[model samples]
Target chain A: MAIQREHELHSRRRGRNVAMGLILGGLVAMIFAVSIVKLSQSQSEDSTAPNYVPATAGASE
Target chain B: MADVSSIDTREYEAQFGDYVELLKPRVMRLVVFTALVGMLVAPVPVHPVIAFASILCIAIGAGASGALNMWWDRDIDAIMKRTMGRPIPSGRVQPGEALAIGLALSGLSVMLLAVFANLAAAGWLAFTIFFYVVVYSIGLKRRTPQNIVIGGAAGAFPPLLGWVVATGSISVEPVLLVALILIWTPPHFWALALWRNEDYKAAGIPMLPVARGERVTRRYIFGYTLLLIPVALAPSFTQIGGIAYFAVSLVLNVVLLAGAWRLLKRQESDRDADNFRAEKQFFGFTIVYLFVHFVMLLVEATLRAFDLSITALPIWF
Candidate 1:
């Protein structure tokens, strides 16, 4: 009975750690996803910007 | 029957779980996030698909480093309470197997980045893996109290690597991002070390708290936390951030400094339940503090691109 109780306590402690890890991991993943989406949106916006100066002109000048 | 039992014991070691507890997944997420931010914030424009490839390579490289770190630290890990249940220590994974996996992943990640991204990004990725596995884990971790201070540079590389991926070169912005993370690392880690000093002592690892007295360690932690505020506020002066980031940085730094001061001033005997709880809160807040700072930067960059005036903070040239 004592051995079983100790085992249960060990598993309980492990469960807590795992839960904390999972929560933190989920938050990190969400942040990464948000950053990626924002990056994509920014890139699209940049592509639509007007290019008054010709790409080759600056190099030649 | 006894002979058969002995033979069964030899054959029945726990199997490895590649999908779980490799520490790869956790480290990979940090790498991906920081690198993505770097790519997005860079002055040079990168193609969307190329950017994706760059983040992916950085993630793989980070994972490879984690695997190598696991392999190398397996021995020490088995003795430490915190790491006692890691795959290798728990007999779920063999050291040789981990070594092979780490090497294979390291080569593949670097080569893929070199081909798909730029040589500079790939070079940084390779160096990151080398620094984590060789310089930090093997050279500094066991030998010095300044382990995290120097090893922190290994973790700081992802942002710089990401910048190179986008711009095909390095610059002041990425260096500043690297510096912010490097400065933040010691306080973040030392707080945990303070609480878990006993485990480190038992494991014979030369963490700051284990090597130096806890009083000295607390002073170091306070000093780092104080230094981190200025560095954290640095982005606000740069073109990357604005008044919103500056406000957040100011308020957050005050809170962080307060926590560090409290931790620093507490007596040895007073490191009981309440004190420990306070330290834990500080540690948890530190994580959110960093995430919020980075997220604000990302938001500011997006606003700048749109020519939207969120705040009138001066942008450093």
Candidate 2:
């Protein structure tokens, strides 16, 4: 009996899968980075803008 | 019954590069460069990470549009010698797959841009994609001779989108960049249309040269190039331009003018064995013309940032 061998179709599929994996992985990394940046920027801007929260809270005292 | 097991899968082999080619990577480079310059030259500085994300979204949006264009124009693309080997037309990538990639990337880019950049920029990116895919590719291209003139706006929007990404609002400086590309597109595209007029005729694209006579086309190229000089020079007077920009603009415009002039003089009778020497030269110069202008603006902005004086420097030396 002859030994079985992987066909060319498998390699092409593997190539597509690997490429898709990289693209999806990169997108995840990008979204994570962008979210972190947005949060940090929001925090920085809020710190400089003044705190009305404490002023409103003092009325309850 | 067809032999399903015997069917060849070799023809279906599409590498990652095929998908990149589908996105029109060549055109994407122009978008990326112009957008980068737009961000770099904006009055307000963008954070590096934010800038990176912003440009990426814009580029992806541009790529998505290109893929959609390939999907829509697949029929004509197959006929045109220039585009026949393109992924969709050549069968390396399927039409449905191209459409899916285009739509998916378009949504991803617009959403990411809104989250990362401002809503205004995101909205503009979405509009740019729609304009390119719908307005240019579908609406204008087949129906009118003025397709490129109107469709050119789709290409010209990148710098403005980049500007919006940085400043979060529109302003004259970046609007100037937008105008620069708008005026530049006609001659840039028309010059190629003059040389590759055959391709346009074959593809039924109704390019300026195909719809109008070559003489009229040449005249238009000269006319637009004439208009381009002042528009290109206008930046030198504005904040976008300085002494360096002024001098460089003068030289580049003169060079482009000379080429456009030579092309205008050349007739169909002047084509020596299918060689559009003057037309080809003008087309090449137009690329350099847009590139150098944007580069100069970036240089001007960098100089201003560091407070270096171009006039004070030994420029000629």
lDDT of 1 at B183: 88
Top-scoring candidate (DockQ): 2
Compose the digit string of candidate 1's lDDT tens values, residues B57-133: 78878887898899999888888888887788887777887888789778987987886666888999999999999
| Backbone atom clashes (below 3 Å) for every candidate | 0, 0
DockQ of each: 0.04, 0.28
Computed on alpha carbons, the lDDT of every model, listed in order, comes to: 0.79, 0.84
- Candidate 2 chain B, which ten residues in sequence have the lowest lDDT sum? B308-317
Alpha carbon lDDT at A10, candidate 2: 59
Model 2: residues with Cα > 4 Å off, grouped in runs: A1-10, A42-61, B1-10, B310-317
